[model samples]
Target: MDDPIMKHNVPDTEWFDRSSLRRMLRTYSLVYIKPDVGRKGNGIIRVKRLRAEEFEISYKQTTSLRSRDKVYSAIKELLNPDKEYIIQQGIDLATYRHRPFDVRVVLQKPLGKWRTTLMCAKLAPRRSSVVTNVSKGAKDYNLYRLLKGTDQRLNRSEIIRNLIDVSKQIAQILGSHFPLKILGLDMGIDKRGNIWFIEANTKPDCQGLKKIDRRLYRKYLRAKKIMRNG
Candidate 1:
């Protein structure tokens, strides 16, 4: 999923390591280091290059200002020896009321055709949190309402169309190799209105969508029924 998106619209990402971390930090200024098998944004770290040699590593409730080597070592110590990690270029995501937010594009396969069923925005509770995971104190909002007054440079309707198209594309690509029923594409929109694929979730949680819009939730249920009947 990321491979197709990366070739086109998504941000640059690579496996995390001392060498790659140093290179990506130089290239991206701000990069995210995340565990390969973590959820709810747990064990995710945000690394930012501040000066020539100074950098910052921010994890849950901890932000450390240190030199390049020290920052690397600190991250290394926090990592599990057996688990893999990834380094991703961080996009300065769009903000709603001073808090960073990201869109969740939900796509479902009904009658063997992919359809975009739901679009919800998750806003971080605080500016310090690294992710907008609903489990991490993030609040869900209606996608259209969230984009209502913030930035008007980009056309909202067009953005929504693009998001749905890309999400369906991702689902189609992933479905080729596996039996994909639904996808929850975590997407970020930059200040410039460029949409980036942050990540993809195969078994997406719909609790946020249910809380935000029951109509969309009912639609989602109908899609699931089609899947089950088929």
Candidate 2:
């Protein structure tokens, strides 16, 4: 949100509250609320404004339609009141076999220069999942094949190149502010092939890369070794 150059790729995001909620819902038809320090897609809430005075909120497997006045209460019921949350505009994620997915870009700064070492994706196991989180039962897919094979109409090559460029730029920009050696960025692409910034992970969990692609997984391990030695 701070960088002007990369901010444009980010979805509308703000602190989660009654005011921000009402204001954001008024501006955008869809919004998602997530824990500030959450992981594996837990404690996330999806809210959609169907029409005036009618709202829909979905969490995990349960979904409910609430009136305009009761929307907040419904969302609050699913939240752990102790934790802080962020409300963000939801993206119409590209789907594969009816399941939505998101891209994961691994950038490592070995001996000072930043480079994207690995690119993969996590596909949600079911259509109802609020997130495409691997730890929470999502399946890993080869980013290249997933983008190229399924979306026949899109320019997959261009999207891949753009993802690399945008991800590297984000790494460089964020690296300047934090003393981080590795970053796992969660990136999103809509059906129209436009890329969006989701989140940046300082301690990215890329442990099981072998399942997606053996070669890229080996490269990821090598990058980790180099970053560790330095």
Candidate 3:
């Protein structure tokens, strides 16, 4: 329930009543509507801001709407009164060559101490989508290739430090909450060099591990074994 990435010193998001949400949507520039208990990147929507005179809406299910009233009505009609949901602020992610991308950081607690096992870059599909979850058709790029590739503003040291620091911080926070032996964190690094907590997965994909730094992985394994045997 605690998301340090939410910022604003606000408490964890709570379920808003129907009228309250409408009022909030009118006030907040952007908001996300997601299932409170959903998993595997399902049932989430990034609602765009509505101008005083113009309003538009789009989703995976319905991509086209002509009028503001229609958009509002459609959103309201899709709401599930029986289910719990959260309204979150939308984050404008950093882009790579005009295409938005996010970083997928894999963390494992093998023995006891938390360690980051792998890091991968996920490029969102050309279509407009807020999340870069693979299930949502986001393409996975080689992490090292992207990092090592030419970008005048970014240096290798900065890239590594940013990812490493954020990964460790997120692992520390989640570990404090659940005391899990292993966990995977999917994080977002924005254009302004801000780190965001997208979501955490109990079972993370290890496919990208083979492509990441071997030395780091070895250290994690060695530390995990020591803790397990201790």
Candidate 4:
């Protein structure tokens, strides 16, 4: 999945290793270390290189500032030896009202072809939370309205269009490799307006979309029906 999206300039990501960690941190300055099999942003840690030898690791509600080696040892202790982890270059995501947020693009292939159905923004409840997962106390906002009045380099329409195009591309590429019905794409927009792919879920949670806008949910249902009947 990462390879296919890399051509689209998705942020650099690599399997978690001590060497990769040091290299990525040195290059990106900030990175996210996440469990290979996890959800709702649980067990995800954000690591930042503050200086040549100083680092910071943040998880849940707490952040530990320590030397690079100590930070690595602390993180190593928290990991389950049997489970795998990944290191991803962190994007300085755009914020809405001082809280970081990411766009969720929902694509459904109830019919033969994939179609974009819903787009919304998930905002972190606090600045310290590393993820915008609704289960992590984040709130959903109307994608358009959320971008309204923001000082982003890209206008609202441009951002929406780019997201749709990228989502379609990802779905098409992934569909060729796997049997997929629906996709939930988490996307982040940098301050410079560049969009990056965060992750993709085959079974996406539509609860946020339903709660944020019933109209879109109804439309999604209607589209599903049309696809089924066709």
What are the models' TM-scores?
A: 0.94, 0.95, 0.76, 0.93
lDDT of each: 0.85, 0.88, 0.65, 0.84
Per-residue alpha-carbon lDDT of candidate 4 for residues 32-128, written as tens digits (9 for 90 to 100): 9998888878888898888889988888888889887777788897787888999999998888777888998888887678888888999889877
Question: Listing every candidate in turn, what is its Cα RMSD in Å to the true structure after a full C-alpha superposition?
Answer: 1.7, 1.4, 3.8, 1.9
lDDT tens digits, residue span 186-205, model 2:
99988888889998888888
Ranking by lDDT: 2, 1, 4, 3
Poorest 10 consecutive residues of model 4 by lDDT? 1-10
Q: Which regions in candidate 1 have their CA more than 4 angstroms from the true location?
A: 1-6
lDDT of 1 by residue, 1-230 (tens): 34734466767788998898888977988899888887888889898889979988888888889897687888997787888999999998888777888998899989989988888999999977788998889988999888886643657887888888777777877788999889888999887888888888888888657878788889999999999998
Among these predictions, the greatest lDDT belongs to: 2
Q: Stretches of candidate 2 above 4 Å error?
A: none
Can you list the residue pairs that collide in candidate 1?
none
Residue 127 lDDT in model 4? 72
Q: Give the CA lDDT, 0 to 100, for residue 226 in model 2.
A: 88
Clash total of candidate 4: 0
Model 3 per-residue lDDT tens digits across residues 1-230: 35545342232244655654566667666666777766656777666755654554555645544344455566666667677777765666666666677777777676566677677788778647756777778877766676555332456567667777767777777688786766677666656656676667777765555546666567656755775786
Give candidate 2's TM-score: 0.95
Residue 119 displacement in candidate 2 (angstroms): 1.1
RMSD of 4: 1.9
- On lDDT, who's better, 2 or 3? 2
